[model samples]
Target: MNPVVEQMNRRRSVRNFSGKPVDEVHLGRILLAAQQAPTSINGQQISLVVTRNKETIARIAEIAGGQPQVAGAEVFVTVVIDYHRTREALKSVGAEQVIAQSAEGLMVGATDAGIMLNALQTAAESFGYGTTAIGGIRNDPQAMIELLGLPAETFPLVGTTIGVADDASLAQVKPRVPLATFAHMERYDAEAVRRGVAEYDRQLRLWWDEQGLTQMPSYSESTAQYYSRVYFPKVAESLESQGFEFRDD
Candidate 1:
């Protein structure tokens, strides 16, 4: 396998940061890599709000369930889905601007932001920095919006903490689903999921046993429970507050 590909394969989320500032040059290079990530139609509808302020990072950490990793990181980058820029561009050209109410707009904004985040993470890893994604930034979207001073049509979609890893940080890489079940060739295989679940459960059980832990719920069992109800009831309201509409038409 290629060296970079190999690094990606072995990469795992790390939550323990040493609170050391990333080198200025490395940080610039990492942002440059993220900027180079592909965007739909080259619209570049995403922007980053990066901070090295420990005080602000600490406050954000509290909002995100007090994750120490976030509070201690040297750099915290917020990936925002920014349609505000689009509106500005339209205004600049005296073109009529339209609000995004359909699913396609949401999909494009989210996918573009997510791809750029992957590039940022990969570049940071290449420079030996530990990285962990912070999805909990949306726990209270209104608070984040106010804290970051984000304007309408701009929302903090996700966050990433970057810094050196502590020696006592997480080291185990979680196992992924079997490739056959995860990826299909030519045509979809309906039975692959059934077989994959059984094999995955068995493997997970063995792993727990090796670690001297009791077996927990199987992957399907846990996922089914989690999806049984609407987990984030405020997400719709949050989106609306940020000028995103969900219209039935």
Candidate 2:
């Protein structure tokens, strides 16, 4: 396999860091990689805020559902989906309105943020750094917005913590669903998806058993329960309160 593919395959979330600091030059390169990530129609809708202040990191950790890694990592990068900058640009160019509050605009911004985050992660990994993405940043979107001093038309999408990982913190790579499960040729295949998920569940269960985690539920069941009971309700309310308009009409 190609070296890049091998490196990517080795990537896993690292929650326990060694607490050693990352060199500034390497951090600069990682940020540069994020800056070069592709965006929709050249609209750079993502902004990154690097927080190295210990006190601020601790506060962020509290806001992020008490993820200690946020405070203990060498650095925390908050990836924000920002239409505020674009809105200002439009105003400067004499455009009458900014349409960043709509669903389409939100999707574009979020996509840009995700792409940049991937770049950041890959770059950090290539530079011999361990990183983990923190989605808990959205657990309290309003608080995150106020804490980060984010302006209107900007939202925190995700966060990444960069540091050297402890030997014990390199978790085993978890199994992923087969490509056939999601990749289709021209049309969707419901049967393939069903079979694929069933196979994946079996594989996951085996892996969990080997790791002494037999209580873990199947991927499909867990995801369905989470979205239906926990994720959607909270996220929808948070997004709406942050000026995002979702229209399904």
TM-scores for all candidates: the values are: 0.92, 0.92
In model 1, what lDDT does residue 215 have?
51
Q: Tens digits of per-residue lDDT for model 2 on 1-249?
A: 998899999988888888788999999988987798898988787899999888888988998889887878889999998877777778898984345656788778778888888999999999999999998888888888888898877788899999988877577998888888778989999999989999999998888898888899988878887777665236666666666775532
Query: Candidate 1, after superposition: displacement of residue 181 in Å?
Result: 0.5
lDDT of 1: 0.85
The clash numbers for all candidates, in the given order, read 0, 0
Question: What is the C-alpha local distance difference test score of each model?
Answer: 0.85, 0.84
Q: What TM-score number comes out for model 1? A: 0.92
Model 1 ranges with Cα > 4 A deviation: 211-217
